[model samples]
Target: MNHKVVSLFAGAGGLDLGFQMAGGYDLLWANDNDPDAVSTYKANLGNHAVLGDIREISSEEIPECDVVLGGFPCQGFSLANTGRRADDARNVLYLEMLRVVASKRPKAFVAENVKGLMLMSKGEVLRRIVADFEELGYDVQWKILNAADYGVPQRRERVFIVGTRHDLEVDFEFPTPTHGRKPDSGKLPWVSVGHALGGLPDPDSRHDLTNHTYSKYKLRFNGYMGHRAIDPELPAPTVTGRGDNKGGVVVLHHPSNERRMSVRELALVQSFPLNFEFACNQSAAYRLIGNAVAPSVGRSVAQSLQQALKTAKVAVKGD
Candidate 1:
């Protein structure tokens, strides 16, 4: 069958690339608010993403599609924000998705966000979101996924809420973890940071020196902002979407070097191809990378969705 996807919150095309690479979806349209992200998306994924705020774009303008993809703004629901509330403006952004889904009525939809969303208001926020989607006639399900378990050399945990139109026979099962420290699950050991960054030479070669460049002043406030050096022996912690290459940002320091991890190295850890450029300054590059859905994790979900679609069709035919 065909999988035509219309994506919202399409930042730098991470999730979009994953779905396209997973090989069922033909991306019909995509949207995002950031100019740089839209530029990067066009550069890396071709010209599909529209540059504008989702709130302003009416649902009628969105093309019809089988799946709707969103990586909604997570700050309002993130643990980093202690002042979050049920009425937080950002918390309601998913309603924009609801608007589009209600208007387009896609067969399936998927939304990704920081894991903190599950704990917001002791989970009331999540319950409400699920209820709203259910009211849309979707069979809703969600799970917290750790990227390390899905082949990315990062342990970033995220929540994915997937919905199938109520009438479909297939249920969306979150993909099982394929990597862990213990042996009982028949899974491979988690990919270490070394697995991704071990091949680079000392950060002086032009390629290394240029791409692996760091903020000289960042070391001035060393150890501030909870910044720590990365450990190559294990998967990295969650990669945040903001970094100044200078101090006053969140980034893991290079395991071997004193400087912060460069945009390329960060992209590698996020499972993005080496050739995939961020097309922005160092800080913007760091910010976009930090904010993106890890492509490896996105691919895992896309693959499962594809399977569910196939199974649902077979069931319908048999009946």
Candidate 2:
């Protein structure tokens, strides 16, 4: 059965693409305020994505679907944001997601945010969010997932909150790790930057690779974010959307420690496909890639959801 999906804050279609890759998912509708993101989603994925603020577009505009997926704006809850505030306005964007879910009442909904969200407000914030979802007549559960554990070549961690309608009578199970620090009986070692970027040509000597351009910001090894040398042998540090004072997006240095990784390279580290093009300028492309959910990690979660829904259907038929 093909499950319909409606996505919000669909930046460059990373999460939506993951669901599409998982099979049995049809992206019926999507929305994002960024013009570049909507353009990219249309160019690569489909033209179903609408361009507008979620707040302005009412739930009535969205079609009914089996699932609601959102990676809601997380700048306020990110640990890398030194200027973050407890009452940061952007933190409430998830409410917009909740409003739609409340209206549409899909079989299940998935929300993603930075790992720092689990610690926000001394954990009170997360508790309250979970409580609110439970009040909507659903079984809500959340966990922190590391992308590298799922074959992404970056050590990015994000919290995923999943809710299933109580009537479904199925508990959602998060996917197990397929890659790790040490190879286990059934798992492979975490993918390294060297392994991920092996065949890409140097940015200076490009050979028709799209969006293969790097930032010229000089490297600084001050131990701060995006300032340290990368270990090619290991997974890359988290890619962030912050940038230098001159307005250039701060991208991680290449494994060779010579220059910053290009937009395409960073996208690769985030597990985006080679042909997935970002329909924007270089700096905007960096922000889009950094803010995206790694497609591989998203696929794992999607697959798990697919399994849970299938089990629920079987149980209903058995009854």
Candidate 3:
């Protein structure tokens, strides 16, 4: 039987998809606020996607599940942008997950956020998040994981927290690094911009504003050629809401080509399935993609969780 999971703040179902790939979990419910994200999630995840803001949804309204997945808003806790003062409302949303955990009491959960969360508010914020989860009766294990370490092309780093209900009492372990070993890195292969966007329309030629294009990688020899490469070896760079617009630094098409990465390419780099279509408009697509958790990472954690559950089940049977 597939393990059941309820996902919150589920953007584009990336986390859910990863867990599914790991071979045991079936998403019982998924939540997201953006219409575009919701649409994409629904299309990809089917009936599980709850198209609305998570805060407005009641815990009782959700179905039962073995695990809960969430990647809450990070603006207030993110170090990349300024204005994360003591009073940002977004920072407090972590409490929302706490509230849901108290009510739903899933067997386990995996929460993700920007790596800066580790040092936010000089670490006080992270401390609070841990304490809050513990208070809700969970044993939490967290680590800074880079997409690069996991074989993604991007160099994005994130903080992942895995927690089990106090009753479970099972210590969670992060996945071992898959890349960077001797043979793999004997000559460390860096998946550069060329690998990410090698042949696409010119970023300038493509006027699709809905895509939210971010920064494109510059070609070393031909700065004017707008070509981006796809490095399959390293973890992919962080997929952001602005990947389509070339707003943030991104792997662009050949400089002369002008087209930024299409939404499908972004999803692929983020480890989404090729057939998995983003259900929203271009801008909405960026938002969902940017906020999504890499499925590969999620699948790794899910595999670990599934093993723990099986071990628990076996112990109970023996007893």
lDDT of 1 by residue, 1-319 (tens): 6688999999988999899889978888999999989999998888878999999998888888889999989988987667877788999999999999998878889999998898888999999999999999999999999999887998888999999888776777999888885634588888888778888765556562333554443543344442766677888878886444443367666666467677788888899887787877777777788889988888999999998887664333212
TM-score (C-alpha) between model 3 and the true structure? 0.80
Summed over model 3, clashes come to: 59
Residues 1-319 of candidate 2 have per-residue lDDT tens digits of: 6888999999998899899999989999999999989988898889999999999997889998889999999999998887877799998898898898898888889899999898888998789889888888889999999999999999999999999988888768999999999989999999999889988998899389899998898888887788888999999999887775332546998899888899999999999999999888888888888889889988999999999987674333212
lDDT score for residue 181 of model 3: 29
lDDT of 2: 0.89
1-319 per-residue lDDT for model 3 (tens digits): 6767888888778888888889877778888776777788777778778778778888889887778888888866766556666468887877778888788777888899988787777888888889889888888888898765665656668999988877756756788666552435443544443454444344356544334344334444243212334334343435555333533343433223443566655765676665677765555665576678878777877888888776542222112
Total residue pair clashes for candidate 2: 0
In model 1, the clashing pairs are 240-290, 241-287, 241-290, 241-291
Q: In terms of lDDT, which candidate is stronger, 1 or 3?
A: 1
**Residue 128 local lDDT, model 1:** 96
Clash totals in order: 4, 0, 59
- The worst-scoring run of ten residues by lDDT in candidate 3 lies at 310-319
lDDT of 2 at 120: 87
What are the lDDT figures for the candidates, one per model?
Answer: 0.82, 0.89, 0.68
Query: TM-scores for all candidates?
Result: 0.92, 0.96, 0.80
